[model samples]
Target: MIRSAYSLQAAEAEIPALSATPLDVVALLAQAHHPEAGAVVLFSGEVRNHNQGQDVDYLEYEAHEAMAEKMIAEIINDAHAKWPLKIAVAQHRTGKVAIGETAVIVITSSAHRHEAYEANQYIIHRIKHEATIWKCEYFTDGSKKWGGNCSCCPPAL
Candidate 1:
């Protein structure tokens, strides 16, 4: 369901379920389009080839679907309260994500670039820290470890 502070005709927001299918960045950007919006910000989190010097094979993501959606909606609402946004949308991928694949995407549109940029950054950061999602990383050497803290790598022992 779309969640937005403005009326349906004025804004758009969404939190889609995690899918094995690749995310369509174009479609997400399209959703944030508005005639009055002059600035649009898009953020994509992709699976990289290496992590802490390990040749990563792939990454697995899991989420509490229902709660995650709710948390994302709250984030959208908070963004609206903080900025004058035309629209905002965020989505996260679940299941195995191969190297170079898009894992998460966030789009925000506003009348000014500063608002769009700041709101976009805030939304992505909050989602990483507040959402109930877990990630497990697999390495090429047959070693694996679960990641902690969405903002950075797991703390060293």
Candidate 2:
């Protein structure tokens, strides 16, 4: 018998990996549902049109691909251990991202809404501050600025 994805067991669930392409929100959401999951939470970190009063033309993101992925997986695992999560997935873009485009995404599911919401928040915040990623902002005026993510180390020169 072919079981619905919603009926899949938690052991069948796996952590989502990091990526550098445009995130498919719909696909990610579809992967997060489980029989125990009554609540699903998604976090989309989009590229806004402006930042710091400057018009943003676009954003360029870079990362130590292997390291960032490892860190994110650890964070998600920690969340699962802390909460009753059925599944979790996260991705970060590594190339040019236009305005209103998603730069990062996190999805979490749990039997309860609070668990899903809290775990989703925890994963996104950890990715922002702990992952070895860098961001370069291309302003509308043809200027650019580089900064490290919340990681303690600065972007490599």
Question: Candidate 1 on 1-157: residue-level lDDT in tens?
Answer: 2333355434353336355578988877767777678999999999998887779999999889889888988888889899998888888888899999999898888988999999988888888877887889999999988974344633321
Q: Write the per-residue lDDT of candidate 2 for residues 26-46, one digit (tens) a residue.
A: 877777777667999989999
Q: Largest TM-score belongs to which candidate?
A: 1
Pairs that clash in candidate 1? none
Name the 10 consecutive residues with the lowest summed lDDT in model 2: 148-157
Off by over 4 Å in 1: 1-17, 149-157
lDDT of each: 0.80, 0.79
| Residue runs of model 2 more than 4 Å from their true location after superposition | 1-16, 148-157
- TM-score per candidate, chains pooled: 0.86, 0.84
Model 1 alpha-carbon miss at residue 93, Å: 0.4
Candidate 1 global Cα RMSD:
4.7
Best candidate (score: lDDT): 1
In the order shown, what is each candidate's alpha-carbon RMSD?
Answer: 4.7, 5.2
